[model samples]
Target chain A: MPDSEGHPDFDELELGAVLTALADPIRRQVVAVLAGEPDGTERPCSSFGLPLTKSTLTYHFRLLRESGLVRQVNRGNSRMAQLRRADLEARFPGLLALVVAETQQAGKGAPSVAGNTARAPH
Target chain B: MPDSEGHPDFDELELGAVLTALADPIRRQVVAVLAGEPDGTERPCSSFGLPLTKSTLTYHFRLLRESGLVRQVNRGNSRMAQLRRADLEARFPGLLALVVAETQQAGKGAPSVAGNTARAPH
Candidate 1:
C-alpha cells in the first residue's frame, strides 16, 4: 500500500508494534471489521464508525497498517484497509484466532465471566 | 499488591495496556513463568534473567504487574511477582489461554514468524 507521504508504511512495523496497535478495542473493532473483509479489497476509513475524529481514525489505521495487521491501498482520495491475515498468522500462529475470539467475546458477549475459571491442563 | 507509590499498580492498567505489556516476548515469557507459577507466590525479577539492564528489568516487571498480567508483592528488598490468573481470566476470558499459546509459539518454537497462508473459514 502507498503511504500518503510517498513511503511504504505497512512494511515497517514489527510484531510487537502490530500487536500493540491491535490491543485497543477500537483498533480490534477495526481489525475484526477488516478480517471479516476480503483480501485485495479496501474499506473506507469512515465506514467503520469509530468514536474518534477523522485524524485519530487516520492514526489508528496508520498504526494497524504499519504493524502489518492491515494493508491499506489508496482508493481515489480515500484509504482502504485489508488485514494481513496470512502474514500475521504465519508470524504468530493461533494469533488470529486469539484476536478474533477476544474481539468477538469482548463485543458480542457480555456475560460477566464470573464462573469461567481455569480448568488446569489435564 | 501495593503499588510502590501508594496506589495499586496492577489494578490501574486497562485491558489494552495489559495486552500491550504482554506483546513483547520477554514480557510474555515472564507471564508464562508466572502463570505456570502458583498463586499467593512471587518470583524475583532477576530469576527470569532478561537481557535488559536491571533498571529495565525492574521497569518490565513493573509494567507487567501494573497491567494485571502479574501481581507483585514486596518480598524483602526483592519484589516477587505472581500472575493474577483468576482475576485476569475473569476480566478477559480465554485471554490467559491466548497469552500462553502465543508465548509458547514464540518461544519453544523458533520457527520464524512466517506466513502459513490463510485457509478460508468455510
Candidate 2:
C-alpha cells in the first residue's frame, strides 16, 4: 500500500509546483483522463496508454503526486492513479478544469503546445 | 516599437507554454504584479524590483513573452512589459485569475514554493 503520508496536503501544495507539474503536455493529458474518471475509481497507472516508457510515465506520475495534483496507491499488485480533484479544487478552484479543457482542445487538433517539455522544470 | 509579429497570436498560444511560463515563482510574482496594473498600463521591466540579475530578469521576461503571458515593447528606450491578460483570458478563461488569487494566498504567509527555480524549465 502506498502511504498517503507521502502526498502533500492541500494547504501544503505550492502554486508553482502545481503549475510546473501541469506544464507538460503529456502530464496535462494524464490529468484530463483522471479528472474525467468517476469518483473513487483508481485506474491502474498503465491505463493512461501514453506512448512512453514505464520509467518516463513513472517520473511524470511522481511529479503529479509530489505537486498534490494526483494520488497513486497500490491496489493488490497494480499501482492505481487518480486525480485529487476535490482537494485541488478546494485549494485552487477551476485550475484543473481549465487544464482539462485545454487538453481536450489540443486533442481536437487545436494549436500545439510547442516549446513545452515533459521533463521536470530544472 | 517592438513588432507584434514577434509575439504569438491568440490561436497560436499553447496551454503548456502558459503553464510552464507560470511555473517559476519569480515569474508568477511578475504576473501577479502585472495583473494588478490598470488597463493599458505598460510598466518598465526594471520597475519589477525582483532580486535578480539583469540577465536573469531578461530571461524570465523572455519566457513570459514567448509563452504569450506578457508583451514587451520599447517605450522611448525603456522596455515596457504588461500582462497579456485579455489574450490569455480568451484562450483559457479563469486561468490568470486563479493564478493571481493563488499568488495572493501565497502572499498571506501560505506555504512557500520551494524547489521551484527562478530559471526557465529546461
Candidate 3:
C-alpha cells in the first residue's frame, strides 16, 4: 500500500544496478516468484520461502523496486509485488527473459554437476 | 604464447565466481570477441579495443581463463582463446549463449533508448 521508497521514480533506475540487485540468488528467486504469478496477483514477500529475516526480505524487495525490476504496492495489511517485465525488456532487450530463464536453469529440479562453465554455444 | 596463469585447469572453477567475473561490461566484451571467433582462432588481447593498461587486460583474461569461461593455449607469439561453451552449458545450462546474446543485444547497431526496464513478459 505504501508507495515505493521515500520517492518511487521508475524512470531513473539503472540497468547495472538492477542486474547487480538480481545477482543474488535469493533476490532472483523473489523475482521468479513474481514472474510466475500473473501481473496483478499480489504475493507477500514471505511467500518466496527464503530463509532471510523479515528486514532482509524488506531490503530485497526494496532493491527490486528501486531497480525497476518490480512494482510494489500496498494492499491492506500485505504488499503486492509484480514483475516489471515489460518495463525491463523495453529498456534492455532480451535481458529479463534471459535472467528469468537463468533462474529456472539454475533450479533444474535435479541434482547439479559440481561445476559448469560454458559448454553449449547457440 | 603464454599458458593461462602460472597453472591451468578447467574443472575447478565456480559458477558464481564465473558469473561475477563476467559481470563487468568490458570483460563481457572480451567474451563476446571470443564467442564470435571460430573455436581455434587466436585473437590477441589487444584485438578487443579496450583502453586499459596491459596489466589490467592481462588480469581480465586471467580471470576469464581461470573461471573456465575461455581456454587459453600457447600458440606462437600470441595465445589462442576459445570459449569453453560445451563445458559451461553442461554445468550451467543457458548461460553462455544468453550472455553472448545479451552482449549482442547490448551492442545494438541502432542507438539505445535513454533508459529501458522490463516492459515485456512471455
Candidate 4:
C-alpha cells in the first residue's frame, strides 16, 4: 500500500508516537469508528461528525496518520481515513483491540461519535 | 485508598491521560517494571535503574501517578511506586495488560530497563 508523505512507514511505527496519537480522546474516537467498520471502510473525515472544527479535525487526523494509526487518502473531492488494523495488530497484538474496546466501553452512555469525550478509557 | 493531592481519583481517570502517560518510553518502562512485580509489590523508583536524571525520573513518576497508572507512597526515606493494577483494570479492563504486553513485546531484545527506546507498538 502506498503511504502519503509525512506518514510513518510500517517499520517506522514507534510505540511512543502511536500511544501519543491514541492518547487524544478525539483521535481515539476516530479510530473507534474506523476500526469498528465491518468491511475496512474508508470514511470521509466529515463522517466522524466530531464537534471539533475543521482545523482541529485535520490536526487529529494528521496525528493518527503520522503515527500509523490511520491511513488517509484523497478520494475524489474528499479525504477519507481508515484504521491500519492489520498493521497495528501485527506490530502490537491486543493493543488496538483494547483501545477500541475500552473506548467503546467508556463512551457507552454517550458515544464519542456524539461529541462527548470518552470517560473511562480516555 | 487515599490518593495524594494531584493524583487523579478512581472515578476521575480518563483514557487520554493514561495513554499520554504511557506514550513516553521511559514511563512505559517504569510501568512495565511495576506491573510485572509479584503480588502488587511496590518498589522504590530507583530500583528500576533508569538512566535518566533523578529529576526526570521524578517527573515520569508524577506523570504516571497523575494519570492513575501508578500510585506512590512515602516509605521511610524513599518514596515507593506501584502499578495501580486493580484500579486501572476496574476503570479500563484489559487496557493496562495490553500496554504492558505491547511494551514488553516492543522491548524484547533490549528490554526498556536498559534505557533503549521501545522499537515497535508505538
Best by DockQ: 2
- The lDDT per prediction is 0.64, 0.78, 0.64, 0.76
Task: Estimate, for each residue in B70-118, the C-alpha lDDT of model 3 and write its tens digit.
Answer: 7877656666566786677666565666556665656777323122221
Q: Return the candidate ranking by lDDT, descending.
A: 2, 4, 3, 1
lDDT by residue (A1-122, candidate 1, tens digit) is 33644223434435567667766667766776677656556788898866568998888887776667777777788777777777766555555655566556555565322111224545
C-alpha RMSD over true interface residues, each candidate: 6.7, 1.6, 5.3, 3.1
Highest lDDT, which number?
2
Reference-based lDDT, residue B65, model 3: 81
Q: List DockQ, one per candidate, in order.
A: 0.18, 0.63, 0.10, 0.41
Better of 2 and 3 by TM-score: 2
TM-score computed on alpha carbons, candidate 2: 0.85
lDDT of 1: 0.64
User: How should the candidates be ordered by DockQ, best one leading?
Assistant: 2, 4, 1, 3
Better of 2 and 4 by TM-score: 2
Model 2 bad stretches (over 4 Å): A109-122, B109-115, B118-122
Which candidate number would show the highest TM-score if scored against the true structure?
Answer: 2
Model 1: what TM-score? 0.59
For residues A67-109, what per-residue lDDT tens digits would candidate 2 score against the true structure?
8988887656667777898998887888888877866765677
Classified by CAPRI criteria, candidate 3 counts as: incorrect
